[model samples]
Target: MNTRSPWTVVICAAAVVTLAMGVRQSFGLFLPQMGPALDIGRSDFGLALAIQNLMLGLAQPFVGAIADKHGAGRVTLAGALLYVAGLVGAAYATDAMGIHLTLGFMVGLAMTGVTFTVMLGAVGRVVPPERRTMAFGIVTAGGSVGQFLVVPGAQLLLGQLGYHMAFIALAGLIGLAAVLAIGVAGKPRALDADGPAQSVGEALREASGVRSFWLLNAGFFVCGFHIAFIATHFPAYLADKQIPPAIGATALALVGLFNIFGSYAFGLSGDRYPKHYLLAGLYAARGLVFVLFLALPLTNVTALAFAAAMGFLWLGTVPLTNGLVSQIFGVRHLSMLGGIVFLSHQVGSFFGAWAAGYMFDLMGSYDAAWIASIALAAMAALVHLPIRDAPLVRRPLAA
Candidate 1:
């Protein structure tokens, strides 16, 4: 029997997520500086983030499988080192290709090893089912914490240290998460199955057959699109309106701050209510928020209010979506299965990040993207309604 406390796993995993995601949220803040410095357009910078999101999604299955079979600690440690490398490399990069390689390629692969797939999987394995969603909320909130705290710090670094030295500083911060990897170091425990332990192929095949899984993926895609577009482009979008840059940073920071509570509230509620229903409501609320934000006057107060509202809704989907996955398919192969679902989310992120910039370059406004967000929100709200939230009942192979 394992001796480590479940909370230990949660704390360590959350800490790592905080650093990984915090540094990540800070990237959009870099675009203002990077664009002028590298002589690149918004689309160029957007493409780099697009590549990173796509690469992260593409690599997740393998990384999750590795973590599932071997141990999360090793995977996390390696990812942390690679994350440092990517940041440091991006620091020195002078061209589009160079930024794409360092920031897009290397960091993308690194995230698979460090972020939600492996970390949440670790918690799923350790925390009891009754408490699993709450644990997920705590971990999901860690990313926001990073955003709240790290984004502003990154802004300060950018203003003071410039992008190069700022990146180097960020590298050192993520390097610390490498050591915390030890806290999550353990292989998946054998789960109770109808037959022998399911092979990775078997897990894939089973999840593929579940209709709700695909629906969950579709819903998550909207989430990815919304977050990727907003996180990467929202700062610049604000700058276009002649808003002070500091307000943009504060707006993102508020998102991070409020999401902490939102994640926890949603996570706690998931344990008490129907997860799919909660997810549906969350998406619907997001749609309403967007509508209000767009309809209101564009002022700093309105922007910050929008951020706070969006923040509460943000990342709440993570624990809820993940809870649905675990609720449907047990945690036996949670990492790999969740990774597949997340891959769908990342694909949307690629489009969201790239498309906004493309639209900006072509149309001179983010109006189209914002409208798309509203529509996607409506779609996501509808999609989760049909998901089958019951646990899967397995039949013995010999039956």
Candidate 2:
């Protein structure tokens, strides 16, 4: 395997992220049925996930820093252990607090280790610079493959076995991810050819001075909100519309399926076109799609169609977004900067997950959540426009 093609790293890296996320995606499958089964409300469920995203956001920059200094393997292994522990804990969770601590905090910590912000940044190092967009896209596309492959199995297993068993199985799957992650051991790229290392504080000051950094941060917030709200609430909303939970699984799978294409396409486009404009159009289109879905019928057919449409727009942003960061900043501190931006995304996720639940708890529906997501999408589209994607000069910091 060490003698294998460089794409092998990309494949393993993406697969690792995919498998990790695939297992986590199943958590939503548990929500529609699990809440009632456990005598919890949507608020409780949402808060748990909100905490997870919060932890994920909080941990990302730190994880990114470590990946910057050491390598991704240690982070991935650590994350895999946390992931397995979280799922195991969640499987037997008897109270809302347990869910919050285990599923939320534990999973969040683990995911920070495994997610693409760190992994793909690592991939960015070895891959040729010209093909970076396509490479990032292809690696990210593997995550889509996980989403598609895992959600249905989760839904089906939930149907045939039960939620508890599903969690155990998912936990086992995460253990397998740890084994795969061991293969990720290798030499990491230097922070730069010139610099000894890029400190997080130094990275922050540099990234903060740049307009594109904040734009990327702000824009990523919407991606978090969009993903968290839908991933958490879609099934419940579908069930409200009288659709079977299975339909919810199918819709999610469609999102995964279409995302495979969307992510790669957008990644390719990012390489060929100006990335910010592409990002702007993507967010804008997402808003329109949300408007159409909310304004029209709520059938399984429509929901599945919406899922497919949305999926295409799904993580496709990741490659372009990550690409832009690496491009403007240089790949030296790519993981750290990307993680900081991803923190904004997770912050949005925290609100999206919790707010969607809180809104539903207050208003008796997800209409408010959908409307809010639309507005956020519009704002995100505007945020990226002023970003300067060109590289900034690295001046000596004040001693």
Candidate 3:
């Protein structure tokens, strides 16, 4: 029997992601400094982040499986150590290959253990079904909070200490999450004691056959693309127009700040409304936001307004998508199944991050990439329209 309160577990999971994701949100800030210093182009820098997103996706399911079998606490502790090492290594890296290996590969792998898959699974197991979406919202908001606070601080460190020292300083912040691991340290437990038992293999087979599951994946892919492209390149895009670098940082920080409200509000709504409809509306809103931003003249006011609008819509997808997964498939293997769905998101991220840079290098403007994002957002909104949120009904397996 567990002794800790459910909220205790939820809050700790939130804190860990706040640190893990907070530091990551600042990676784009490094490109201006790191790119010029190492003589690497934007494409190479973007490729490194693309690699990181790919590695992060590739490792997630295996890491999720391990967390499922052993304990999230142990997995999180090991990941935090690797996370610290990756940042420290990135700090000392002198070339593109070194950056890719440490920031792209190591940190990517490290994130699988510390971020959403493991942490949300921990929350899913502890909280009841009725409250799981709200709990997830809280955790997702924590990441945004990290974004709001750590990003500006990162910019300051860049000004005061340079990219190398900034990386080191970020490493120190992530290390603190290692101690918080104990809050989530345990194997997956029964959320509904009376619920039928399902093996991991059964869960996989059941989910694979469902149309809604695939739809969820399709929509989430666009989400990944939007996030990775904007997070990895938006600042540079602003800089290209001769906007001050500080506004770019402030803009990204505003996304984080507004998302804090967005995540919680969406989470609260998911519990009351049809999640599919909510998801569809959110995606459609993104398409509209992108279209308006592109049509308008670029300025400090426009950029910050864009950030605020996009931020509110940003991570709300996480809790809704995660809730959809749990709602349809059950949380028995959430870490693993959520990881699989997330793999699709990461695949989109790889392209989003890489393609933006590749396009910029070729075309010298982000207009094409922004157009692509708008189109993809429309596609995501359409895909989620047909999803049915009811749970799968399965016959009990033979003993």
Candidate 4:
């Protein structure tokens, strides 16, 4: 057994996720500047980001499989290097194609190794099952903290150093995560007491046969769509309403700040209450929040309020969803299974980013997209109701 303390593992995983998610979250802050700088339309820029989201989703299952086999630390280090390369390439990119290749594909691929799927799996393996949800929450909150702190810093960099230099600075921050990856090295030992150890193939075969697994994936798809659309287009949406750029930055920061509490609180709640019900409530709350935001007049106060309200709901699903997956399937192949669910998320993200841009261009407004998001949130709320949260009953292997 690797005898590393659970806290030590959590801290390192948290640090790695913080840096990875923080840098990724700040990408939207660049869209307004990047479009004008490259002389590209919003739809074109959105397409590039859409590709990035697609690649991120497409790569996760493979990356998760590698981490399950080879260990997370090596994969994380490689991801950090690719992340740096992608950012540096994007900084120098003069056209849509170059940015698409670097920011879209390269960066997206890099995230598969660095973000929630990998870090959460690392944390899940080390912590006891009873405490897993809270542990997952702690790690998820780290990403929110990154968003809280990093977005403002990115804005300041954009103000003082320009967008290209800002990308370089962000890349340097990701490099620091490589050092933290050392703590989560090596394959995880099994903690289940009853069942004989299962191979990755066995785990995958069992999970693929379950209907609840697909339900979880569908629910997560909604999460990706909501997050990517809001993160990528919210600032621009606010700007179109004639709000100041600072307000948009502040709104994003608030979302990050409040998400810290939301994630932690939801994680704690998942341990006591039924996670599926909590998830149902969360999506419903999102639908209600959108209704209020759209119905009320848009103001700095309303915008900030909307950001704070939405922030509390943001990423709350991550720990709960991941916890449910581990709870049902066992943690033997948690990373790979989690990645499979997240793939659906990334697919939704691709459409969320692309669709928003395409819709805005055609209709000259984001009203239609906002309404669609509201509808999806309601659908997601209902979709989680049918999941059975019991562990799979796998028989012992033949002697």
Pick the lDDT winner: 1
**Residue-by-residue lDDT tens digits, candidate 4, 167-250:** 999999999988887888876655522245777787788888999899999999999989989888999999999999999999
Q: What are the clash counts of all predictions, listed in order?
A: 0, 1, 0, 0
Which TM-score value belongs to model 2?
Answer: 0.96
**1-399 per-residue lDDT for model 2 (tens digits):** 123355777887888888987776667778866788889999999999999999999989888888877877788889999999999899899989999999999999889988888787678777766788888998888888989999898888788888888898888877877886765655574522123356668767878888788889899999999999988889888988899878888888888889999999998999898899999999999999999998887787789889999999989889999989888877877888888989999999999999999999999988889889899989989998887877667666567
lDDT of 3 by residue, 145-194 (tens): 99999999999999999999999999999999999999988666554222
List the candidate numbers ranked by lDDT, top first: 1, 3, 4, 2
Tell me the whole-model lDDT of each prediction, alpha carbons only: 0.92, 0.85, 0.91, 0.90
Off by over 4 Å in 3: 191-195
Q: List the residue pairs that clash in candidate 1.
A: none
Model 2 score (lDDT): 0.85
CA shift at 69, candidate 1, in angstroms? Answer: 0.8
Evaluated at residue 91, the lDDT of candidate 2 is 85
How many steric clashes does model 3 contain?
Answer: 0
Error of 1 at 96 (Å): 0.7
TM-score of 1: 0.98
lDDT winner between candidates 3 and 4: 3
The TM-scores of all predictions, comma-separated, are: 0.98, 0.96, 0.98, 0.98
